[model samples]
Target: MCGIFGYVGDESAGPIVYRGLETLEYRGYDSAGVALRSGGSDELTIEKRAGEVAALSVPTVPDAISAIGHTRWSTHGAPTDENAHPHTGCDDRLAIVHNGIVENYEAAKADLDEHTFTSETDTEVVAHLLERELDSLEESGPDSPPRDGSPGRPDGGTASREGESADAPDSSDVAWRVRRALESVVDRLDGSYAIAAIHERDDCIVATRNESPLVVGHGSNAAFLASDVPALVEHTREVTYLDDGDVAVLTPDSVSIYRDGRRVEPSISTVEWDADAAQKGGYDHYMRKEIHEQPTALRQALGSRVDVDTGTASLDVDFPQGYLESVEEVQFLACGTSAYAGRYAATLFESLADVRATSVTASEYAFTGGRDPWRTLAVAVTQSGETADTLSALREARGAGARTLGVTNTLGSSVTREADDALFIRAGPEIGVAATKTFASQVSTLALLAIAVGRERGTLTAATAREHLEDLTALPGAIQQVLDREEQIRAVATTFADSDAFFFVGRSYGYPVALEGALKLKEISYDHAEGFPAGELKHGPLALVTDETPVLAVLTDGAGRRESLNNVAEVQARGAPTIGVTTAGVDAGSLDVAFEVPDAGVFSPLVANVYFQLFAYHVANEKGRSIDKPRNLAKSVTVE
Candidate 1:
């Protein structure tokens, strides 16, 4: 995935766009660039590089009022200065920055054989296409005379030449031509994209999106555009998320949205969180701050929605009447951490709701298997709400006539618009590439959903529902208790920092936590780790156990602790040092190192996850790893 930002305002454009790119650093990019247009200028000033955004040298452009920038994660070519974004047209009058793949870029490039291509990026084809369209328009002459009373280009060529402004096109004419050219360019392209372009002769920015995210920020005497909210939170809280096939024109005064050549209006939402939420908040790393923010995040996820006394949860999800009652099965579609969270939810739903449930990896999702669409409920779980795979799976389910629900942390994300209904996790902005707080919030919110569904289906009795709700209400405090023992976790993690490999084994609900634990460690620490069901160890994985391979076991109550302990003993017998996260009063002598988890019934395993997160964080911290922006990972995956 790549990040794109654009601004048209009274202030200098270069620094504002550069700052926006910095806020999007968590999206993970290898190269960055910016293009700026000064007042009354007919040429774009472009600067780009092949490394970090901090390394990019952005020159000061006095009176510059419009700009666009990009941080690219290479897809078609290697990360090089030549491959960086803000690509220009043949005349260097138009600059464009793009995110997402152009599937037919080769065909488009071939069609424009006369245009000189400079880079190996699929995005470069769009600039050339726009140039061709503009050239055609110049050859045919303006349909209407220039509104500014300036003469048209009589030579039937590009309007401006180096050090020559005698035949420069009027600003209004240039803007009109750029808009028409962009529409033509989009028609020629296929596949997902979020594109933004600026012409030196135009005083506005033109942008569009299809299957990729683009948000327009409304500010005083200014307009802004970015791929995500974090980039615009500081400048403007009010935003309008563009829909597919919608082209947006941003000027200093207003934002004009058009679709299929007709002007349209889109709803605007105010960002609830401020810029401070995206910062580290005085922590050494975003991962650490987010890990520690779990308590507050859990509280936000719960809020007043859970009523332990009545054994009910008001999630504000507008499911159709009797929808919960008509559900014959529940299917969760997700990927990566959200997939693990779904695994946990699926198990809970089956056990508590007396319903058949399954978790499908969204990328591998299929709607077949003789399932009835009318009786099936498909739930898409994603933290960012823009995950490409999960969104695809949701669309597939909906196309099959299944009722689709989106569970996500972001407000006004693509998932919210695409799904029939949406439930917010309210976990706030998570900037860390390695997820921490969102995982906790996702599980907690899903747990609430399961409770509400079970109650509505009459499968769970009031007493059972009350007990589970009570456990959930106490979960935030239990996680805080675990957070209080950070020093102990740090010590154990440091001791095993030099271990050759790590193995995590658990049973029941803990199985998903074990998998997530291994994922966190490998993602941030760059360590070798594996996680599987505790019983499966003896089947084959036990052979990998040795003195140098430490095994971490989840031994919390109500999650098959006794059976998991037997597997712990199996690893210990192979000379593997064992660490256990268990409930208080569990036999600590059986573990080489043990972390106490507060008693919270089935939720104790979730509390134990805090220990795993701390262990992963400290280990990565000790190894001097990039804990916030892990290599080759983006915070929000906007591309498939």
Candidate 2:
């Protein structure tokens, strides 16, 4: 998950790019860069570094009105100046930045043997290709040759056939040359991307996306493209989600779109969320604020997934019916918190639909691989939809001849573009790095897909699916009921504030919650927390129960999972002070603490998982870590 922002309007590019990336810090990145084409100079001036954008001491932006910036979550190479984008072609002739993985980079790299490279990035290949195109376009443009005085280079020009570079273009010729170069360059790309380019000769900004997200703000000349919405919402609520293979060129005075070499009008979408929704709202940290936002967050998601007017629950998804018919078995693949959602969905999938389901953690999917179990279906789950391991597994499943479906929150995200069919998790933009609302949304989408399958196979009555969808629609209220207990959780976190080691135990569906609980604390809190299947205690983990390690147990009463409380008692007998996540008002005072979740179905993942996330987040915040941009824990893993 990387943050990308561009401005082509009258606003100052520096502040816009900076503030935009600040909001996107939640996306997670290890490096940052900005390329701007000022009104005068043609070349794109770029300053990239190998560290958090928040930590950067970048130089002030030049006086140009149009600029583009990127916050990179490393994929092709290590975090370094040479590896960060915007990557340049030969002698900075062309510049580009990209957000998706190019599966055929090795082949592209071989073609670049004659060209010199300054960065070890997959994204740089676009620059090289663009440079080649620009070189060919130079001779035929309205402007005969690019003049001198570019931004990155005070002088700009191309290299001669004999290998000597030509003089740099002057300021007046920058815009025309840059635009022509880009038009030619853009035609050669073959993979997923959301691209924004600064042509040195043109007064405009050239931007586009193919199976990637690019949104144009409602303002007459303003435009934005991000993997998600919140980054651009600061400028305008009226927006458009660019279609697959669509190209959009933006300028302060104009915006045009194209599809498969033909011009087309893009559909506009209005977003109601305010910039303040992306802010922490007086909370100590964004993670804390988002964790508390789960209840309303869940409700908002439910509202989007189902149409209130029709009372007919639909995925609100657009895909060919033929795609669904091709799917058979489903392998639910994801990493970390998302994987738990996948596990719950696997159960939901099998019960609601006539399909067999297998849940696999992305990290281990390859190792467990082999065999034609059936004409398989791959359902990849991710909050950001950019997880590296999951992407590889999706490709692996596809290679195995399975139909692929993507369940993700980010529209135009990589997984959505790759899948044969996709169901969007209407979670909006999840700002907290540890994930609260996103996790719930993943479950929501997966469940809905299951319902959709049930509808298809006739296993689930349409009325039953509709009623459950209605219940799902009401889940926001139940979620809100849980968020009201934030103060209570804050108080509880203080109790374990000084503890270093912890144990999380649960049974049944709660097992994943316990595992997720352990994961959240370990990721950001720097705590050594272990999650066990409760029943696995006697096998080995029980030895670690001690006064020093606070034991967290899942005990949701009235949820048919009473056996978990027995293990909660077992831990207490061993002198491990316990904290339990259970249904509201179930008193387990002997357990030292009990945080509550409303009794829900396997839909319980929608509530309980969030509560545990809150528990971990508060503990980390109490320890004073950057909860939103956790150390070494990225919001999205986009490289394998």
Candidate 3:
């Protein structure tokens, strides 16, 4: 996954592109670059670096009105200056920035033996191929095939050319030539891509996407292109989501869209989030800011969805009156943190909605399948809504005739558009690579979703629903109590900073929280952490425990509390230090380290999770690890 930002505007483009890249830093990239060219100038200036966006020095280009920037995650080559983006053509007249992979790049490269390449990247081949395509268009008319044995002519065998002579090409043909060249280049590309191009002779920016995300920001005097909404949300909230095979030509005043060489109308949608939500504010790191914002995020998710007095939930999505009642089972498909959240929701669905619910990891779901599609309700849980594997799984479920619902934070993400129905979690822009507030918000929304389903199925009485909603309403204050004990959590983290590994054990609803706690530790602290059901510790994991290992257990006043405490006793008997996250009924003297949470019935895990988050954050801080941008992890998995 990478970030792309481009601008065609009246003011200088350097600062806008730079700030946009900063917003996308959480997407995880190793290299940064920017290509700037003034409206009337024929020369392009390129600056790049192999580190973070802040490391890339941008020269003052006062007159530059159009530019494109990229933050690249190492894919084709290692992070090096030569491998950075904004790659140029052999003639040095055109520059291209791209995200996603080109599967046929080697074949494209083999044909350009005469041309010299500077970078060891698949993207460089496209730049050279574009140059060759332009050369062919300039030498021969649009009807002639490429002499380099590239892909053949366009599908219709080229345009009429309006009777223009093949021997001589006019200046007016340059725009047409660029368009045709891009078409030919895309035809040869076999994999996913989102590409933006700029030529010295043209003042406009051209972009296209296939199996990758590309959006356009529509402004009064400018139009911009970016890989995601946050990049350009500050400048304009109105955006056009580009579909596969769509080409957009953007100038200062207009954006003309074309699909398969035919002009098409654009679908413009408005984004509600302000740019301020994406900022770190006064917090030291974006992750910390998000951790503290969990209360507000939870409130936002439950605002209009819950009826506090009546103890009922109303999901703000299109659902046929009896559709939910007819569902015999519920299947959840997701990846990573979202998958963990789905696991938590699955437990609630089985108990509250009285349905068989199971969470399947999105990538592995296709290989293992035995379900009655007609009676199963498939739910896709994702934060960005653009996760590749989750999207694929949702499509597969739909093809099997299962009703699909997308539970996502982003409004216009691919999952929202492709699924049969959508339930938005309303957790505004989350910029941290390691999810925090969004996790809290997702679980809260799923709780409400379970309540709504139960109410429709007549499985949950009004009094039971009231109790659940009351617990949900108190989650914010309960989590705040945990955040207020940050210094205490820091002390605990400092004590366990020397541990080699961590083992987290829980049961029932606490099981998913245990998994998520371990995930947070592994993600931010770079520690080897494993989560398992409490009863399974003796099965295999208990043998790995040593005095140097820290055992963290989630035990509350619930059905599994006794079994969880037995597991904790088993760990303590092995001389390992035990840390228990529990409610009031569980005594603090029972464990070596006790992190207490307020008693909230089945919702106790929500409060218990906050302590684990704070503990992980402090531990990562103690270890001097990168808190926000962990190595080899991206915020959104746009690529499979």
Candidate 4:
């Protein structure tokens, strides 16, 4: 989940990468770095810092033509300036910034010598390996035909350390030398990686993704590459999503894509979401800003699923004619917040698509036995495609010959590339470790996908689906209604902040929303809150409900479902503070406090999360835990 940025343009890559990293800082990382092929040197020069990207200290960003950068969530080493990316190798002749783990880096590192390498990071292994391989290739192939018709020199330029002349191997030669080295290095690596590099003396930047993410952003005489669109949102709307095993080289005047050593067709997709979605505006915390942004986020996500002109609601997938028809079952896999959405998706699929979709944690799905794979569809969901378990599950399912699809927010994440089909959530960048908008967007996308299946099968009528589509457009306002209540919820949160423990309960669709709310509380507030289906209260949870306990229930304006309301009354009998989220117009009689939300056509985990997140966030703020960087947690799931 590291945020990566690269640019070959008139603009300073330092400023672009720095700000872009800030936009993506919500993903959580320990260190950051950027490498530029400065005009004064033929070798790649770099600067890096531990901690936040904004904390990186650099002397100056020279008016260089190209640069590559990474904000890392550390894996192989502790968070420190020395472990940061843009790691130099081959005596600083090549620098590389990487986003994923290197499984064989140690074995690869052992094979290289005479190439001085710095840093203990697995990413450095890539640089050293690239440097050595390229050097070997150059030596074998009559020496890289001097980059740009310039004289080549040993040791990549300068006299200070390597006995190289001041006139040195030209900067252009250094760049070509580096690129050739990188191309050879690319051929050897394994595992997921989005690699960006600045070749010594080379004027252009080259990047590649193999089961990782990289996007290309367009500019007038400028180009950009970032792990996610929000990093490039400020620069351009026209972007290209790189597929797995795709290589792209970007220069100010051109961007080229290659696949299997041949020029490949690259589709440029225009991004509708812009810099505004990535910025926090005036809010002190991204959670708060994103809680408020949910209104617009919901509208946009819903907009993509439905074509107003066609009056149809569908996931943006067109399967082969016989695939969906032969599908007999579906397994929905995800972890964390996306997992909660998957639970609800299973329910929606049962009712709307008339299919039994079993929702399971990705780890179990990938490794467990006794699951039927034939005639099944594996749907994996995540805000970031780099999620390991989810990706592993998708791989296993595909190995078993199941048709697979992915619903993800990032354009070119591993999940996006690995799935037989994939759809991007338009919720933009969700910075808070606790997902707010994307959670809602994922479930909404799932619902849309459900509707799409129904439409494709003729199980759903066009008019009813069309009305659901229109109601989705109004979700922005419904979300706004919830955002407007944060100040009031802040007051409510104070009542629960002192409680020793919290219990959340819900039934039917409310169960997943309850689970997500509990997760948000656990993720940031570090609270001991747990969600249980209302039916489970009598089974065991009732023993924990006492006067000191607080009960936050998803009681959205529903008529008594017999035993469920009776269970709620049982909680009140124990004198637990019962905070209920209900429809605004409903009379929530005798409830301690009723957090009212606008009535969405269906019970939405996203909208419900907004209200619950406000309560948890305000409680966390009152309890004084850092919301942005919770203890023992980092953004981006880089480590397994």
Candidate 5:
């Protein structure tokens, strides 16, 4: 994870590009840079710093009309001024910013001995290669076409269009040259990358991506390119997601796209989210704000999709006709918090839909074999949709002849495009590296999908479905009740903020929430934490319990509560302090501490999770940890 932003419009480009990069700060980066070019000349100004984007010494380039910015998360080299992005060509005629690795950079650098290298980064090799490519294009006359002789344009049209006189080539022709140069360099590179380059001779930005996520924002007389939607939401919601191997040329008044060296019409879609959703509002951090926003997020995710009157669940997914009915098995693949969400969904599908469901880590799923291919429904759960492992796994599942479904928050993410169908969680933009609202939204959406599948398979009766729908609709209010107890959770957290270790134990659905809570605690507070099923505690984890280690248990109002309470007693007997998260009526009499959530029927886990979120947040805050951007973590896992 890195962040990229580019702008081509009539307004000052530097400030716009800078603001776009600021919006993407959540993605996490070590260095920031911007390249700007004046409209009247080839003069380009580059300002970069090896630190936060705000620390970058951006100059006032009021006349610059085109710009590209990058927030580099170090991959090929150390985070240093010389290794920062916005790398320039040897001749200073081109500036480029890139995301993802170039596996063949060493070989390319071996061939670039004739050119002087200033930085020890793989990205510098790209700038040099593009510089050579552009030189060759200039050597060839304006009328000379690309090596393939396909008119050097995607559409195979001549430089001059119908009704326009065939005249001397101008800046538009330079735009073509830039595009062709990029295409040439793209063919020589190996491995994943998203490159954005602006040449001194043209007021355009040429961009291309292969195995990395990129999107173009279309606005009135302006166009934007970014690695994520939030970077462009402030200016315009209309965006065109670039598929693999697609090249795009953007200018103030136009955006032309190409794939496989042929022109393709871009599908423009509007983002329904308001820009203010990504803002922190008055909250201290985005993580805290999102933790409080879970109620609204769940409400939006459940809005109008389920009908209690009809006793049916309607999920916005496009499956082949009769696909859900014919499915024999289900496999959910995801990573990190999404994996936990998938784990919970797998249980829901198994119990509600009466299907064989399993959850697997996306990175490891390619090696596991039990897939029935045509009979298996492979579901990928990813909040960002651009997760590299999930996308790769989805493709692998497709190659194995399994139909795939993507559950994602990002509409145009690679997973959404690659999978056969997409189910959007509609969590809007989650800016914190530690996921909050998206996690809640994902689990809620998955529950709805399970209900829909149950109805299709005749496993869940209409009356039962109606009852579950009512429980689902009440989740938002239940989460609000939990949020209302923030002060109580904060007090509990302060009591254990100095604990050296934490243990979370739960049964069934609560098990996944326990795991997620431990993960959040470790991520933000830098504490050693482990979450395991309550039944497994006596197997080994009990040995780690001590007075200094607090054991947190989730025992909702259900059949599993008694056994979970027994496990809590075992931990308490080991001299470990205990904290129980349960429904209001449960008597957690033997626990050192207890947090009560509303009795939300089968959906009480959703409410209990909110209590854990607040507990983790306050723990991190009390420890003086960086709660928003945790060290060594990025919001989106774009690379394997």
Candidate 6:
């Protein structure tokens, strides 16, 4: 995935665009570039480089009123200066910044034999194609004006014949010409993309999207466009999300949207979080700040949705009456940390609601084995809600006649519009490439979903449901208690930072936590790590254990604590040091290092996860790793 930002305003365009790119750097950091158009000029000034946003040197263009920038995650070519975005035509009259892939770029390039290709990128073809379309229009009809300051005839001549006066075409406006050229260019291209183009003669930015995300921000005497909300939150909270085939013309005064060459109105929504939420807030890194914010994030997730007295949850999801009673299976579709959240939810659904449930990686999802679509409910879990694989799986499930629900933290994300019902996690902005707070919020929200489903199915008694509700209400405090002992976890991480490898072992609900813990360590620390069900250690993984390797065991209550402790002893027998995350009064004499967590019944393992997150953060900090933007990892996976 790549990030795109465009601005047209009274203020200097270069600085505003550069700042927006900085906020979106987590989405893509391979390269950065900007294209600026000064007032009353048709010549664009371009600056680009093959590195992070901080590496790019933005020129001071005080009078530049329009600009478009991009931070790229390379797809077609290596991250080089030649491959960086803000691609221009041979004449350099127009500049374009693109985000997604052009699947049929090879075919499109073959047709544009008259244009000289510069870089090895699918995006460059779009610029050349638009250039060619504009040139053709100037040659074939009087409906377009030549770029040079000259009055032209329908023929390739600048002067008219004797006794003949040439009249300017009605559609000779710069915006009209650019829009027509772009429409022609897009018709010849294939695949997902969010493209913003600026011409030297036009003081506006023409942007369009197909299967990729683009948001238009409305501000005082300004207009902004970005791939995500973080880039626009500072400028304006009000935004309009662009849908497929929607083209928007953004000027300093107004934004006009069109689809299929006809005007259309799009609803504008305000982002709930502000720019400060995206900052590290005084922490060493974004990952650390998000880790400590877990308590508040969990409280927001549980806000007013759960009723402890009634032993029920009102998630504001509108499913048909009697729909929960008719459900025979619950299938969760997700990827990465969200997949781990889904795995945790699957266990709770089966245990609490007495239903058959399974978690499937979204990329490998299939609705097979003769399952009845009407009786099957598919839930898609994602933090950004724009994850391509999960959206693909959701579409497949909906096409097969299954009612789908989306659980995500973003309000206007694609998942909210595509699914039949949507549940917001309300975790706020998470800027770290390695997920921390969103994972906790996803699990807490899904736990509430399980409670509601159990009550609807009549499988859980009122007192039992109330007990689970009480544990949830106490979850925020439990996580806070773990956050208070951050120094102890940091100390443990310092000792194990030099270890050859790491292993995390747990069972039941703890299994997903162990998997998520290992993911966080490997993602940020760049360490060798693996996670397994505690019982599987003896089957094959035990041979890899040694004193040089440190094993972390999740021994919290209600997550097979006794069984995991036995596995910890097995690791100790193999001469491997064991670190146990347990509750109070647990026998942890066999563990080399033990961190006590607050007791909250089944949610204790979630509290234990905070220790794992802090340990990973400290280990990466010790190794001098880039914890916020880990190498080769982008924040959101927008491409399949």
Best by lDDT: 6
lDDT tens digits, residue span 205-249, model 6: 988988788999999999999999999998899999988888888
lDDT of 5 by residue, 540-591 (tens): 9888889999998888863278899998888888899999888888787778
lDDT of 2 by residue, 346-460 (tens): 8777778877788998877862355453357778888776676787788777777676788887665668778777877666566777777777777777777787777776677
Evaluation by TM-score, superior candidate among 1 and 4: 1
Task: Give the per-residue lDDT of model 1 (tens digit) for 1-640.
Answer: 7999999999999999999998887875789999999786567899999977888976589788899999987788888999999998789889999988999999989998898988999999999888877777676666432323333342334343333333223236666577667877887788889999998876699999988889999999999999999999999899999988888888888787866655566578999999999888899998999988999999999999998998998898887888788888999999999999999999989988878999999999999999999889999999988899999999999999999999999888889999999999999889888888999899999999999999989999889999999999898889988888899889999999999999988899899999999999999999999889999999999999999999998999866898888889888899999999888987755789988888888878888888989999999999999887787887888778
- Compared with the true structure, model 4 gives a TM-score of 0.85
- For each of the candidates, the C-alpha root-mean-square deviation to the true structure, in angstroms, is 5.3, 6.8, 3.8, 6.2, 2.9, 5.1
lDDT of each: 0.87, 0.69, 0.85, 0.75, 0.87, 0.89
Per-residue lDDT tens digits for candidate 4, residues 1-640, read 6778888887666676777777766555688888887866665668889888768864255776678888777778888889988787757766788888788888887887655656788888887777665666566443333322333334433222232222222224444455445555767777778888777766777788776667898889998998877778788989999887777778887777765544555689888777777777899888888888776777778875677555577666878886665666778889888999899888878766777688999878752455556568899987887787788888989998788899988775678767889987788777777788888888878878887786776667778677666656667787788887778989989878988888887777788888888888988888899988878888999999998888877766321234455677888998887887776676665778877777765654345667788988998999998898776565556445
Worst 10 residues of 1 by lDDT: 145-154
The residue-level lDDT of candidate 3 at 513 comes to 87
TM-score, cand. 5: 0.95
* Ranking of predictions according to lDDT: 6, 1, 5, 3, 4, 2
Model 5 clash pairs are: none
Q: Model 4: how far is 520 from its true place, Å?
A: 1.5
Model 5 misplacement above 4 A: 145-171, 367-370
TM-score of each: 0.94, 0.79, 0.93, 0.85, 0.95, 0.95
Q: After superposition, how far is residue 105 of candidate 1 from its true place, in Å?
A: 1.2
Off by over 4 Å in 6: 140-172
lDDT tens digits, residue span 62-126, model 3? 88888888998878989999999899987788889888888889888998899999999998998
lDDT of 3 at 238: 96
Candidate with more favorable, higher TM-score: 1 or 2:
1
